[model samples]
Target: MEITFLGTGAATALPLPFCNCPLCCKARTSGGKDIRKRSSMAVNDDLLVDLGPDTASAAYLYGFPLEQVQYCLQTHSHSDHFDPAHLITRLPEYASAGVVPMKVCGSSLTLKHMSEGVFREDEGTDMLSPEGMQKLSIQIHQAFPYSTFSAGRYRITTLPCGHDPGDGSMVYCIQDGNSTLLYATDTTSFSQEIWDFLISYEFHFTAVVMDHTYGSGINGEGHLNQDQFIEQLRIMRKNGIAGEQTLVFATHISHEGNSTHSDMEREHAAHGYAPAYDGLSIRI
Candidate 1:
């Protein structure tokens, strides 16, 4: 499995446009890994996790071919994560040629909101309707927490997340061949139920990309800080969900109390994971 981080910044991204904080200022001046876009990921060349507002830009910047993506696992309807305007571009009206059919998997509520978002952009365009889906060459697969489903060559298990409970936000455990990945972001610490589920499933992850929206000692609602992030890694290790060879990465990074990409790597190296930056790709 090859995992490419299309973007790895929090909702506000690495640098606040109007703020001149030390971190943001440094990011503006030193634009490399420190520069981040909204959070999103691509699995191999076919599957995408979160078709966010920055997805196209990230793909262009990172040299990923967006036309090859056939499946999307949407976490929620958050504007930063799901951009109806972008999705709408696949429509025939845009004159896009040979667009690959896409299957979008998410909670019912999330799909509903996505459909509504499309409608908002183009009046009367309902993603939930068969006619609308056919027009866009897309399919909606409503997923529920704890359910397992197949998308192409991948086996996906949906796990509930602590953020946006109203939207039934979910994280994913994806398995392809000998590799398994746990993609968890835009979330708080895992719940006991989720832990129990992982333990019961006996899932051993090859890679993990989790939320680290806040830096050490900083508290953020509906997202994990550095301390909480480390604690979760410990629990994963204790439960045998992650082994010593497992590749772990922290994503959804924010500028609030968080240092630049290089500094973050040095700071977090001892914890068995490094911060993921835009365009970073790993294969297992």
Candidate 2:
């Protein structure tokens, strides 16, 4: 199995537009891995996690075969993670005839937001055309904690996390035979119930992707900093959820963080945490 990071930055991305921050300034001049887009990932070529606003741009820039995606696994309804406007581009007018109806799997609240954005059409105003909704095809599958479902060749199990209490959020455990990966984002520490559920699994994860919205800072109730990330790793290892062979990654980066790409890689090398940049692909 292969994983492709479509975008690996926080909500505002690495460089905020029209800002003269040190990081953004350097990013403009030094355009390599320092540049980042919104957070999103693709599993193999069929499953996508989060349909962010940058999904279209990332697909074009990185040559991601998004047309092959059959399932969209949403973490939350945050604007950066869920962009229904961009998703409509897959309608019959824009996509090919072979494009199948995308099966979007997420929490009830997340699916509600998607439905409202996709199906809600105001014929009274010419702002959003009804043709897109009329021609588009999608199947919404509501996901809950501990519930497992199959999409294509992948089996997914949803784990509840501490992100949003009102709408709720999830972390996904994806598996295809022996290959297993945990895609955890848009959430902070794992909840007690989630931890209990996770520990029951027999095998260690092949790769564990974490949320790093804030770097070396206090917990923001919804995101994880570097300190929290490390602690979480320790706990996972102690609980047998991760082993030395497991590949660990930190993504959802922000320019406001304490370190740059190179700096973070150096600082976290001892802990075996690799910072994820846009377009990075890993085969597990």
Candidate 3:
């Protein structure tokens, strides 16, 4: 399986455009890996996670054939996570009929926001002509707490992720045969049940894409502070959630959680993991 890191920054991405915050300033001074887009990933040229604003750039940089994606897995309705406007571009010019109806799986909130705000044309769709607004072959699946489903060769299991409560959010357990990967983002520490699930399932992991949003914040509610995140990693190891070859990655960096990309990598190195930057690719 091939996992492509499209973007790995937090909601606002790395350097928040016009800001002089210490992190942003340092990012400007130290360009390259320090630069981050939004949070998203492309899996095996078929499935994807989140559809952020920078999809075009990410695809271009990684040489992804945008029309080739057959499934899209969403985590929530955050503008940074699921941008329908950008997704709709796949309807016409960007993709022909062969690419129109790819399945989109996510929570009810994630699906509802896209259907009502986008597919239904609830309002403001004048720009997309009838041809551009062709009804897509989108399949919305329920990604509630601990729901599992399958599509073709992959098995998907949604786990609880602490981020939004009213709308809810999820982390994905994606597997193909012996290889399983935990796609965790827009999350803090796992809930007790989720922690138990990780312990109960002794599958060896190809990788763990984690949410490192709070960096060093005090228990920021629904978000993981650095200390707690490290503790959880320790537990994951103790419970056989990872093997000696399992790759642990930290992602979703916030402006407040800012540091030079390398500096951040060094911090996670202490936990035996590495930080994610835009365009990094992982194969498992």
- Cα RMSD of all models vs. native, in order, equals 0.7, 3.1, 3.3
**Colliding pairs, model 2:** none
Q: Report, for every candidate in turn, its global Cα lDDT versus the true structure.
A: 0.93, 0.82, 0.76
Residue 97 local lDDT, model 1: 90
The digit string of per-residue lDDT tens for model 2 on 1-284 reads: 89999999988887888879888898888877888899999888788999998987898787778887889899987888988677766665555477666778898877666666655532222212344333555666789878999988899999888788666688899999979999999788877777787887664799999998887865566888989899899988999999988999998888766467888889888888899889999898
If ranked by TM-score, best first, what sequence of candidates would result? 1, 2, 3
Off by over 4 Å in 3: 92-97, 119-134, 218-221
lDDT of 1 at 190: 95
Best candidate per TM-score, number? 1
Residue 173 CA displacement from its true place in model 2, Å: 0.5
Answer with 2 or 3, whichever has the higher TM-score: 2
Q: Candidate 3: how many backbone clashes?
A: 1
Residue clash pairs of candidate 1:
none
Runs in model 2 deviating more than 4 A are: 93-96, 119-134
